[model samples]
Target: MSVTLVLIDACAASPKESRVQGAVQAVPKTAVHRVVVQVNSDDPVIMKHAITNSLNLLKAYGDRNEAAAVEIVAYGAGVNMFREDTSPVKDLLRFLHATHPDVVFSACGNTIAIMERNEGHPLSLVDGARSVPFGVVRLVELQEAGWSYLRP
Candidate 1:
């Protein structure tokens, strides 16, 4: 009896081709387009620009019928933008979140703790803002996941 060998690339083969001689094949999964925007400045104008850039990217992807996710991470003095009492763009942030629910705003928890210690009072964050353990760590994680990084 002669033996036969058939090589198959799971990613290149379809489901029908995956089953060969009672063997199942696996395929590589594709990732969605994602971006991370980093903000470390206390300037309202800089913060606004970063938000605008994220929005513009989302709009561009939407117009092309492609799905994209955006995450804005704030650390250091930039975390001020997420403070309910001190944020100059609180209304704009609310409006943006209302319009684009997919957009995410993340604040550095470490920064918040430091600020609270200095001020001797609890801090209030703007609605819809989430706190992560560390903003730089978050950025690093996002980058490792194949997300594009922007510091505008």
Candidate 2:
């Protein structure tokens, strides 16, 4: 089964715009699929669009009954999505995680450290997330592991 990974690095917006630059990396799925979104900013608009696009992709898989995995990695200013106390979109984030069992979220440890410097404590992650050492490095590893990359 062929697997594809969506490597999201651009701040999310319309699926087309957010997905254009990274289109080359994605492989069509014959058996499995994965989508990884790397967030690098705190802009609500970007995050919202990213969330929507990821959902759209998931729906595509669900409709086809294709086996797939989805992940969201927040790095740099993107770590704000998982901030324990101050995230502006906590409710929606929670909803997405609970509803989507296959979706995993990762927060960059390095970004968390920086966030701590400003907020005074390491940020807690959302319910269904894992924290990683670095976002960019993880993306590279995912690609190397044969998961096609998408920059949406």
Candidate 3:
């Protein structure tokens, strides 16, 4: 099985293939594009914008056969963006989960616990959304690790 998909440039020989004449450099998956996005608003408009940006990043990198990871960290009131019940953009979230393999939706574990306690029941996140211990800390860690930060 292939480790990852490679896109061959029809116009030029890839460097990975050979060192012959007119060889062009190949963009290996190892050169990953990373971005951490913050979404702390409960507004649907903001949530949609963040999701759109993530999709765009993934598409741009995918077109070049490069690896990309777009992480959306939802904390505070923004945690509602990932809630299965309260999210206004749950449809879009579900679509992304089904179609976009490179995009991640991260809910704050601390926020989740608080919300659950307030509601007196467990809260379910949108399909494919995962929980992190602390959203802000994760954001800081990602930025420290050289991931581009964006707030939308």
Candidate 4:
């Protein structure tokens, strides 16, 4: 149950910064399941389902006293789920982030740039959502790191 906080920069030259926060009992990697959930649709129901599935998986692992990590990555129209103003599930996202430190929300910088360009203003993201250079690249990296991928 070790809690690690990581700060990932979009730039490759900047090595991601990570820190072990409060120590919870640590679990071995083999015992922990890692998942990266992809969200690319603007449909609110799809967004809700993706989040619900991730939360359920985390809860199941916790119930068994096992460890699991869930990352929800958004790009294209799906990036709207992380936007403060347009997100239909902003409160739910914030609540999940507050309760589950093992869960991560990532917003694609490329998508955000396109959105901002269309809107002609900077968009605000929900709290706890991190920016990644590209969502597809992030997915590939996560899969290469042995995380199972899910798109709901």
State which candidate has the highest lDDT: 4
Tens digits of per-residue lDDT for model 2, 1-152: 22233432222111111121233222233437766776778887677766776777776766667656666777888888777676666766776776664465777877787778987866677677667778888777666766656554
Better by lDDT, candidate 3 or 2: 3
| TM-score ranking of the models | 4, 1, 3, 2
* Candidate 1 residue lDDT tens string, 6-121: 22111111121222124442211221467789999999888887877867776666666566677789999999999999997787687668766556688999999999999999
For each candidate, give its TM-score against the true structure: 0.78, 0.73, 0.77, 0.80
- Flag clash pairs in model 3: none
In candidate 2 the C-alpha lDDT for residue 20 amounts to: 18
Candidate 3 on 1-152: residue-level lDDT in tens? 11222222212112232111133312223436778899999988888888777777766776777767667999999999999889988877766766664366878889999999999999988887878888998788778867799998
Candidate 4, 1-152: lDDT as tens digits: 22233322111111233222222322234436778899999998888888778777876777676667778999999999999999987866866787775477889989999989999999999988877888988888788867899999
- Residue pairs with colliding backbones in model 4 are 1-25
**What are the lDDT scores of the predictions, listed in order?**
0.73, 0.64, 0.73, 0.75
Q: Largest TM-score belongs to which candidate? A: 4
Q: What TM-score quantifies how close candidate 2 is to the native fold? A: 0.73
Instruction: Return the number of clashes found in candidate 1.
Output: 0
How many angstroms is residue 13 displaced in model 4 relative to the true structure, after the best TM-score fit?
27
- The better candidate by lDDT, 1 or 2, is 1
